[model samples]
Target: MIDIKMLIELFVFAGDYNWIGKERAIKMAESTIQYSNPVIPGFHPDPSVCRVGSDFYLVTSSFEYFPGVPIFHSRDLVHWKQIGHCLTRQSQLDLEGCRSSMGIYAPTIRFHNGRFYMITTNVKMFRNFYVWAENPEGPWSDPIWPDWPSVDPSLFFDEDGRVYITGTGGFFGDEPKGIYQAEIDLESGKLLSERRLIWQGTGGKSAEGPHLYRVNGKYFLMIAEGGTEYGHMATIARSDSPYGPFESNPDNPILTHRSTGSSIQATGHADLVQLEDGSWWAVFLGIRPVSVPFSGRHHHLGRETFLAPVTWTEDGWPVIGDGGKIAEKMDASTLPLAVDESAVSETDDFNSNRLQLEWNFLRNPQDEDWSLEERPGYLTLHGSALTLNDIGSPAFVGRRQQHFRCSVSTLMSFDPLHEGEEAGLTVYMNERFHYEIALTCGVEGRRQVIFRRRIGSLWKMELVEDFEGSDIILGLDAEPFQYSFFYSLPNGERKAFGSGECSLVSTEVAGGFTGVFFGLYATGNGKSAKTPASFDWFQYIKS
Candidate 1:
């Protein structure tokens, strides 16, 4: 068998003829980004972006995860720096009984007046609201508006200083749903007019994630339709007015993956930005399910962020997504530099602002419950009732694992588990697909290293050792979508156990529309047990 590291090296660098060409082009592009480049990867859904001078700020939905909107900054709309999370306050959301699939939906980020605003839906609570900040890093204000029956809310400001919010709520009778826009008073947070239903959708059904943009005297509304399933798509409509008797783009369903092959399912929820050069590009979410006919298990590499160039017609409407079908490979070389060298850092020294981009909570974050400075050297995670189901739980932090061939390793030591205490690292994909290495106290007052995995209907378990140790390395090696867990002792011997060679199942295969994530967690099972866990650090390498 070929060595995994060698195979990756060969795949990435084997061909030499285009190295200089690739490097020269790539270098030119990196020059534009002041911070990091290719800022994020894989399943950063419902992206919202706003440009303020030379800097660009972006946000994405947290859905059953806390830290509701993740805020990122960029200079060239390329390399993004994760600045902070927008809704860190508790009063902003309630995730009780929030299933793994519920919570915040598509969010819209906008800059208006003197502040920055983000609007989104809390699906479980059935409300649409907005959060704003004077500065991007934010002491963002709490939800100023709440409990409206809408999801995917986008805010629009017209020329005369009128403010409007656009979103998708429940269906209008049986016709799926249409974009709804209502006049809003920015200062008092009041809706001045009833919601006006506009842009029924493309010829297909299920319209959502509406973004309103004004270009060359016309108001354009871009949205995704055809459900977020196999036929996911992005379409456009335009009107002389923001409220719209809008006209659909003749080239409706502007972007898609269906034509290439059903296997490359491209569902688009897009945001557009015009460059300093006046060139246009759209940052949207797309899917490329790995499984052929859709299985009940794994869909490893779907639901990822994709960028495409856009050309405006003489009529001023924008076209996107390979124009019609996603390209197998495009001359990304032609694109001018958007970021300065892909400067993203996957390694964490634990000394930055909170956790690196790697860490994510299960649901909305409990800000007071966590601190990077309290422990100084270690991350302190307080326990919350948010087991695995509540998207608003307080005891979970995770990061995206993008490369198929990579290794994730972390160091953890706990306060010692009593009866109900559990803390560990995990490779999680929904509730159904997860593998964990935990430190739990045994019945005899000793601790044990327990490994567990959910294999179909049963949870398979194994014991590496009977709690004889404290400091240890929990590592996961992933090749393609399959993962294997290992324990590297302080002395450096690797032991494989629990959920051996398990395939990661995502919404694309597991029947949802989300992506895969690996996380660290601590749980208290009703019994009185002190939370005994301090994580040293987490490391990921593309082997």
Candidate 2:
């Protein structure tokens, strides 16, 4: 039943892809040429893309996760490989107390003078900073905090050698709001010009996520508005000069699904680039409703990165999606087919020196609390004072729950000596929204597997059964609105415990800027534990 040669080959490719393994090889056998929506899947949002010769690099918002801003390398735009993160070192960022959707906002990636530049806002922390690296997978330079007076920051190097910054908001009370711009000295990160108001959008609320580009001798300003919800839209304006009293496109709101009732909603915040073939494309963010739609079109996976072709009229303005709609299917491309097996890595063996790129903590983590080499082939997480519901970062590491129909399982060896010690698998949206099936010590040294659900201020926990709490396999299967938990006892008896409404951990219910993350966690309830919890393996498969 097993093909040894194929398995070995798959491992080779997996190592090449960093986090992808057997599942990728199996899926490659069944792979066909189909350009689908959410080209870069999962909870990756606020995509910014740029081209460097035949190579293409794209980065997306990580919000509260770290290392922040996943940087992907793509040769054919359709297939992408996450090479590394822009914020790999602690000196590059600080998200220590960042709550859900409050840390790293949106990032814009561009290339100039043989260097890769990434500029973004760190929300409540670092206001605005830019970093540069010769290679996409860095050793990047430390952040240079620029005095850009906005939230969604972008950099435009003019033909006359002036570098301009464009963004939204009034950073200071007296500064003008809407989309603002200023020229900055790149070396000193100092503003050189007075902040100027560019466009207020086409009268939409919250005109943000702006990108400026020079195409065909015209300066173009593209922005997103309507609050990043169902009413979100993309609009464009252009002028002869970068700092403009620019003219708006009569057919404004160029890219939006509002009022169309399309499955892909809130389609806006796009960045454009021209490929080697001279073909234009855009990478933006969109929310996909679950199979069973709700009154609010509640999405559980959060906003995901989507790819669509962009066409310029003979007049120079950009039009995205097919006939202004992003289609699920498109004609196959002449470029070679590439599949990202790592997007749905079937098994993470925890045998490597570093965690996979997909794994991230709630915020900036205390380096001493987690390790990969302590147990030879396991992830050892020391218990922390913070619990899942606490405001600070807990001893947690998770990957995005990208697909609605999928299963997440882990084998953990944790023996708690006190009622306060606990470790297990969790489906978490934020501090106020999550579900966990954990092994915790009870009265008289008895350890019990418990199911707990936290929604806003209410906390409900149920005892599933008793366990010795060593080398136990815990699992959660999600489908539509339901998520079921299961466990394989040390003696090999399989038991299904219970289920919860998937919406309990959804963005709509949680009221945050993120999606669900299936994570492994160890906690001390309120005190630090005496020993560490070891997880042997983790698996996430999309059905």
Candidate 3:
């Protein structure tokens, strides 16, 4: 349950800390810390973190899900609270072609010049954009610029106060590509001059998601390459100039899963931050092999975010992962846990003013079209045409599949006797791998449940029809690589709808290199696809 009382109390403390001297406030926040040295699962991939005095704000990519960019605040960088969503308006995102795995990519968060800025890449449309706000709790500016061959963009304001942008090229036809840089005008949301490709990637044509940092007297450029798959890695280079002929580290790929070969396949995309005590820590994305010992079957968890401490060697290069795989268990000598343990919330009542921070939209979201408070006590979803595949329609909403054993249920009703109306739950990824249990309203009034997994552009689909489609309960049961569907009939009896063995593959499996997501969607197919449908409530229960 959410601790409303504690949250209210924290507000009072936050205000008091501002009035206190910097040293005094830092001491006060540090003194109350109970949990120190948070271990594994500290955070997820594509992490964006910023420190404001003693408080820190962190966010992660949501990709095609609305309530995009989940925000969290923490005093010790271990315990966190979901504050709000950064991209709440529809104009800020375009999701038409955004497969479940596409949409938002790696994001970089920075605080500068009395404002907070977030820069991210959208791979589906291949554009790099930025959002900013005077306050972190924001009515943030909509994204600026729409199309570019940019992926994984980071912003750096030099000592002279000139802002520069760096990113990896999106096109595959590479001409010895490396990290590139250009002067950028924040006000106009435009690149002022031509971009310079700084360094050819250390490896083959896989370099992307570059983040630039200036520390000591040298400029460090960090990047992820070898694709986001078994060969994923983190490498770095350094130069005296921001636009540089950066020299790759003698021990390049300072962090990687490559040493474990195809077995522990890990992809590393990292963001670096300095702790309040001046220690350097890096938060990056990585994944372990599903079936250990290098089996090619049934992978469990997908790519996830991780934190590794960094130490600067006498030679000025950065060392990560402590000379082994990211240490899963670390001694809690630095930051202790305030509570014994904490986990991300996995349940929803549909009664809050907003969807839980875990909920996201298919692409960018349109606020006027959907409401969690419309029912006042349940989630209300409005219909949109953007089907799962339409980049123009906004017909999708989703949450991450954080557990292998979990059940998703939804309460839904369609406009009675209206033809071509369908609404229900879905485990979606791209146009291909997805399953849905739908309530269809028409003269026939059909309550049909279906399952579909993509093999390419084509879908393998199975449908079972019997129950009347008027306001029914639908459920999807998933365990590992298998799935079973269930629904309650109007007669108040339960029945097995259908079942299928599936490979939980997404755009990543299809070679697009993106994460998978499962959520709820309402569609009119393609014709009259705008017909409105609503979901009373959607819930995820971990059994």
Candidate 4:
């Protein structure tokens, strides 16, 4: 059998002279190349990727979620696996009283000298810092606070062994808004040079998310412009030196979907990577918005990470996607496709001593409110005084709703003592905008099942029914436009209870950076409950 490596080597050696060799090689490798967009889907925004040899590592922004900065590992760049998170310990991230979208923002991960560094800003704390680790799935070091005062921090390790930090400027007192850069001491987090305004974008609003790269003996400064909305775009500038009198690309806005009727919108905040095959690809954040009648476009899944191929022009500028645009499906010749089949599981039985990497809390959780070993084979959540309506962290644990059409169900056993005590499934967007189908004790301590919808300040109990059993199965079926709620008994038939409009919890209506989460929650409204809620199993299947 002829080796595939030898065939590729022969094709390269034949160069432009042998068209037959090139065609045969391309045909032989075509099956392992094609992939869809949003390589890492659902609420994973502000993506940053770094390549180490044949392996690729990626990290995304996790706003107001405990265990911030979800890290992923991939070999083909099209398929990704959640290895672990960069900030796992409380000392690394503190989201205690943070608002829905005001915790971690735009983390840039880079590997230098065999060590991995993730730098980002905690908007709630108003600080810029970075954590380091030897391994991507890690026990990362405590954050080393830098003197810089900006969001979306990125580090560039130069060939001269010097390090430069770049970020969105003008957040400091009286500084003009633009992309800013400064040389820094990596070990001590001290500034080695004065902060300088590098390049004001090409007359776009809110020029931010800066990253610097040296390619073909010239420094390229790339940034996102146009306010991270429908008009969002990625632009680039080139200069002879790092601190530059730079020239913008003649065809600016390297990537965008603005002013178009495409399904994907808000495309920007991109990071570039050069693969081992010397091909260039970019990872950017874009939202897939579903058009609703009388409501324009609404995206409930938040900004997702998208991949696009990059090609260079004769004049030394990079053109992204197809003439500054990308679709839901993309065709590219990538590394041999490798997928981690066990990365995302469809069902979690709650039998392990610890929760999986996909599970995340709204904020820093109180240890006494949740337990995995208390019931041996179930997840027990003690009803906390902090309800989901409050801005505090309640007894809740959730994972991102990754698909537009999916089914999520959980088997819960709870015995409520007070009228306000409730425990069950929640399709949560934020405190003010969510849908909950819970098992609670109604007035006179009567067992009941209630479906409530909270839209801003208006709260309504849409469905209520008396229940007689201690164990119930709660389920949520999500479509592009609506979410249907259901409940059932063990090994029994399912009954539809109510439904909620998906547009109500979308970023267009709710006004947040996060997506919807299907969670299990236990709350006592205003006081602590005497009973605990136990969840036997949870299943999420993408339909």
**Using Cα atoms with residue i matched to residue i, what is each candidate's TM-score against the true structure?**
0.84, 0.91, 0.79, 0.95
lDDT of 4 by residue, 1-543 (tens): 123455566665665476557666556555334577788889999999999998999999999998899999888788888989999888888888899899999999999999999999999988999999999999899999999988889999999999999998787678898888999999999999999989999999999899999999999999999987899999999999999988999999999999999988989989999988898989999999999998799999989999998999999999899988998877754555564443477899998999999999988999999999999889999988898899988999999998999999999999997888999999889999999999999899999999999999999999999999889999989999999999999889999999999999999999989999999999888988789999999999999
Q: For model 3, give the 10-residue run with minimal summed lDDT.
A: 34-43
Best candidate (score: lDDT): 4
Q: Point out the higher-scoring one by lDDT: 2 or 3.
A: 2
Expressed as tens digits, the lDDT of each residue in 1-543 for candidate 1 is 123334334434533455545455445443332322123565567777887776778887676666667788876555566788888766887766677667888888888877999888887877878888999898888887743457788888888888888888555355346788888887767888887788779767778889998888989999988877667788999999998899998878788765555444655788888766777777777655554334432455436555667887786778774565554343343343353433446567576656765467765565654667776777766555444422345476888766667888888777565665767777776766667787766666677788877644566666546756677778888876467778766678888855554344666434454566777777664433466466778788887
- The sequence of per-residue lDDT tens digits that candidate 2 reaches over residues 1-543 is 123345446665775786666566545533434577787777888999998878889999988888989999987677788889999877887887776788888999989898999999998574999999999999789999986757989999898889899889865777655898899898889999988898888889889999999888989999998888888888999999898888998878778998887788889989998877777888899998764454555788989888888887777778897756786665434333444433536899999999988899888888778999999799999889999898787999999888879988888999788877889999899998899998888778788888888889998886557776477888999997899998886569768877888877777778978888999999988899876899999999898
Worst 10 residues of 2 by lDDT: 333-342
Whole-model lDDT, model 1? 0.69
Deviating ranges (above 4 Å) for candidate 2: 1-33, 291-295, 334-344
TM accuracy, model 1: 0.84
Q: By TM-score, who's the top model here?
A: 4
Pairs in steric clash, model 2:
none
The local lDDT score (0 to 100) that residue 255 gets in candidate 1 is: 81
Q: What do the candidate models score in CA lDDT, each in turn?
A: 0.69, 0.84, 0.65, 0.91
RMSD of each: 6.3, 7.2, 7.4, 3.9
Worst 10 residues of 4 by lDDT: 1-10
